[model samples]
Target chain A: MKLTESLSFRNIKGRPVRTAVLIALTAIMAMSAICGSLAVMSLRNGLGALEARLGADIMTVPASAVSKQDFENIVLQGSKGYFYMDRSYYDKIAEREGIEKISYQLYLASASAGCCSVPLQIIGYDPDTDFTVSPWIRKSAGGELKELDVVVGNDLSVFVGETITFYGVTCNVKAKLDKTGNDLDTAVYTDIGTIKRLIAASLELGMNDFKDIDPDKVVSCVLIKVADGYSVDEVLNDLNLHVRRTKSFKTTDMISGVSESLAGVSGIIGILMAAVWVLVLVILFLAVYMSVNERKKEFAVLRVAGASRSRLAGIVMSETLIITITGAVIGIFLGLLMILPFNGLIEESTGLPFLLPDTLHIIICAFVALAASVIAGMLSSLGSAKRISRIDTGVILRGDN
Target chain B: MTITATGVCKDFIRQGKNTNKLTAVSPTDITIEAGKLYVLMGRSGSGKTTLLNMLAGLLTPSSGKVLCDGEDIYALDDEKLSRFRCEHIGVIPQGQTAVHSLNVLENICLSYMLYGSLKEREAAYPAARELMRKLGIAGLENEMPSALSGGELRRVAIARAMLRKPDVLFADEPTCDLDDENTALVLQTLKETAQSSTAVFVVTHERDAVGYADICLNMSGGSIGKQ
Candidate 1:
């Protein structure tokens, strides 16, 4: 070590309590800043992915399901829910003037037994007409899904060539979809024919609530894309005015609620980060200032020993740099431990999609946080450095204040 | 080496309400010549320390000049003057003083370390050990300053001041915390340093210190005169 570094190190080691306090304060500041930024960025990324995955302008669900809020629970939270309207609704929606395309899906919630630990939301879409799930399936599965073949979400523990059973029917896992950072990752998807067989098996086992329901005659929901030059709101109004025993709403309306929750969460985190930074910076400033003042005689003695003013300042800054850099690295590592492993828990608690940003983004955020913490430490000690450098060596060494 | 101060005086502005400037030292001329022990005797606040500080290059006089080897020390900037002091001047201030974190040996070797002289540091240990042995602090080199008693700390300061073998050495109350045996030992070391051609100036209240002096001066009411 250089002489200045050795001196600074000894100064830090001499005051254990003060050193620990400064390190801890900077650690908290770094943790809050990094975790807060990651959380906000992940949420926005998850929301964006969800919007692209929806792949529809509007959705129509059974009036009963809408009234009971079951459709929201199923789609937004991946809760185990199955509500059906007549398959004729697909034809009815296709006949609407502003309708550009239409498709139907059947939802079947599986019991949390057999190969699954948690209940899975199984969605079956018509292979011939699906614009949303099929495109993703082609990307992951590489081709059309054969009979009894299933595509699993990223959160599923099952891998390709594995089989998951639902209601005594075993299905092959063809591929796994990428993460959407929401409850959608907990779902399973298949073609309409396979879901119909599962529905029939469920009905026979007395696992279904609707006893008279026929799988071939019912659809859980209808997804529609409006034609170009036609207003989505206008078409939505026409559906609600003409359709019977069902309700249609814009897909954006459902997303807005999630967006609002995300905004609230992000704001709370931002406020918390700001408050921690301000408090840490203030305490650091006062701590450094008071510490230098208390050591006036030591500095004066150093001056008597022929230390220049700038060298004295250099010693203080070196100590500050060591503490801040150490604290920032520790805090960032702890943040990764907390956020990376428990992302699902965070999503569950916040009820918001929580996808982590890409690797480069995370790395950049950590570096920025590290730099900010070091800057804060240096800035806080700047005043004290200047004050100590300019001490009146003669008066102080003479025992005059 | 010799330090010459001509028409040197100092004034401090008393802080707080009813503030006024007070002269700490009166304009005076003095020369500290090599190979002599000069003892300055005075009561507390008699400006003995102030004058000592000016000669040590630690304080700037309000008027006139202090020259060491034909260069005005006060005229140099902080960098140049501090380097000058490091190479030529050594000071032992009043009361206990140490870089508290460093051990006794490290404190004694601080003169070389402050200037980052790697070669000097390589040679400082043997020289420091010699000084510590002479001051009867040989076994305490590894101990911290806080672990030593007041007298031991005073000896450590003396050892540190002499480590660089500087041209001019100043001590304020160098024997304030020592027993008779240690006090004699310290005074003898100062006299020896003078005999070896370094100018040694001591500010003290002890009458015993006068016995070791080649020249004795007294200060009263901010003015200096021969004792």
Candidate 2:
């Protein structure tokens, strides 16, 4: 070791209690910064994925089959539920003047059956007409979903080529979607033919929600994209006015509520981070100040032994750097352990989308957290270093107060 | 190098109701020449320590200039003056002054480590070991300050001060904590250091230190006079 490093290590080792406390304080600072930033970033990434996934400009659902809130809960909160409307609504919506393109999906809530560990929200889309879920599915599954082939959400424990029976109908898992950090992560997706088979199987078991409804002629909801030059509100009004026994609304309206909730959550996280930083900064400053005061005589001896004022300051800063860096690495590692392994728990608890950023983004966050901790260490120690460096060597050595 | 203090004095403000100023050392002139051992003897509370501090560049006098080899040390900024002290002055402060964290060998070589390059500091180990051997603490190099007795620590300080072969060396109460045998050993080392062409200044209440001095001085009421 260099002389300064050896000296700093000895000084740190000489006072075990003080050094531990300072290190603990820095650790807490770094931990909070990393955890808080990762949480906020994950929520943002999840929300962005959700917005992109909800590709339709407007949607129509059966008025008596599902409440608007319940439909939103199924889509946004990943709640396990299903509803059906007559397939004729899809034709009516397609005939509307402002409707540019239209598609409909069927939803089936599955019971805990073969290879399934829990109840799941099963979404069946028409591969021929889909504009939203198809693009995402192809990105992962690499091809069109075939008969009896299932593309599972990221959160499912099932893997590719694994066969899972829903309502006694067997299907092979084609691919697993990437995480959306929402209820979608827990959902299963399949093509229209497989969904009809599952529905027929459920009907034979007397487990279907609407026993009288025809499985082949029913859809859960109709998704529509407004043509250019037509406002979404105008088409939405036209659909509600002309369509019967159905509710029509803009998709943005649903997302706006989610956006508000996200804003509130982000605000609270920001406030918490600010509070932690301010409190830690003050405590760190005082800790450094008191440590210098306690070691005043030692510094005076260094002065008497020909250490310059700046040299004394350098010694103190070096010690601070060592402590802060050690604390930062430990804290960041702990944060990664907590967040990466239990992201589902966090998403459920916060009721917010919690997709972790890509590897590059995570590395950036770590660097930012490390920088914050080191800067805090340096800033807190600066005053103490200056004070000790400028101490009256003669008086201190003479044991004067 | 010779150090000369001209019209130097120190006054500290008494921190009480009146904010009255107390003069610690009166305005006086003194010159320290190389190759001599000068002992400043006085009672407790005499200004001997303050005068020694001014001459060693550790303390700035409230008035007048302290010149070393024709350059005013007090006129130089803290950086230059501290470097000057590191290069030419070595002070063994009064009382226990070890940097408790470092072991004996590290403490002894602290002067060289302060401003020397890594290679230069490494090269100083041999000289430091020689000083430790002469001071009778050769085998205690790895011991901490807390593990040593009062006199051993004093020898360590002496070894540290002499490590640089400084042009001027100041020993404050160098034998205050020693028995007769150790006291004789320390005073003889200072006297021998002086004979080798390094100026040595010592402040003490021990009369035994007087015999080792080439020139003895006395301080009373913040003023100095030849004894």
On TM-score, the candidate that comes out on top is: 1
lDDT of every predicted structure (CA atoms): 0.87, 0.85
Residue A98 local lDDT, model 1: 95
Please write out the lDDT profile of model 2 over residues A1-401, one tens digit for every residue.
Answer: 46444667778877888888888888888888888999989988988988878889998889875555567777555668877888888888899998788888888788875533467988888988998789889998999999989988888888898887777778899999888888898888888888888777777777745465575798888889999999999999999999988988788887887788888898998899889878988988898888888888888878878888998998898788888988888888888888989988998787778899999999999999999998988898999999888888988878741
For residue A391, model 2's alpha carbon misses the true position, in angstroms, by 1.5
Task: For candidate 2, write residues B126-187 as lDDT tens digits.
Answer: 88888888888889988889999988988888888888889999999998888998899999
* The candidate that achieves the highest lDDT relative to the unseen native structure: 1
RMSD vs true structure, all candidates = 2.1, 3.0
The 10 consecutive residues of candidate 2 chain B with the worst lDDT sum are B112-121
CA lDDT for candidate 1: 0.87
**What lDDT, from 0 to 1, does candidate 2 have?**
0.85
Native-referenced TM-scores of chain A, all candidate models = 0.94, 0.92
For candidate 1, write residues B1-227 as lDDT tens digits: 99999999998888773468888899989999999999999988889999999999999999989999889998999999999988899898888888888888988888766776566675789999999999999989889888999999988889988999999999999999999999999999999999999999999998999999999999998899999
Instruction: At residue A237, give the lDDT of candidate 1.
Output: 94
